[model samples]
Target: MKKANVAINKDLCKKCAICVHFCPKEVFTIDQDGYPLISRLDKCTGCRLCFLRCPDFALEVETELDD
Candidate 1:
């Protein structure tokens, strides 16, 4: 199965929680410091919902091919 590698740029992130709220698979969770955390990476569908929704352009989603 194809998987995704999600990267969050802390310097660009504004802690808007858009990615946290927009993730369909609940792959992200807001940490105590209000940063988005990839809590359920295995559940990520690579749909790019969070990446597209981030206002700060802080999120990146790259599909990983199985060998």
Candidate 2:
């Protein structure tokens, strides 16, 4: 929980709700400008669904630590 698994690429993000809808954990929400906002990082099970579902590759999640 110390590190944020879901990283939003502001430049790559077109404010699309793809990541939002794709997340089963309800971890994402639409911002004022319709950008994908990671509302619940704690709820994230490190599921890569949001990352893979994102057509723009705007979101990424890391469940495990790197060796």
TM-score of each: 0.91, 0.80
Model 1: runs farther than 4 Å from truth?
Answer: none
Q: How high is the lDDT of residue 12 in model 2?
A: 91
lDDT of candidate 1 over 1-67, digit per residue (tens): 7789999999999998988887889999999999999999999989988888888889999998775
What lDDT is obtained when candidate 1 is compared to the true structure?
A: 0.91
- After the best TM-score superposition of candidate 2, give how far the Cα of residue 55 lies from its true spot, in angstroms: 0.8
Expressed as tens digits, the lDDT of each residue in 1-67 for candidate 2 is 3344778989998876877887888988888888887788888877688888888877777677544
Instruction: Output the worst ten-in-a-row residue range by lDDT, candidate 1.
Output: 58-67
Report the error of model 1 at residue 8, Å. Answer: 0.5
Clashing pairs in 1: none
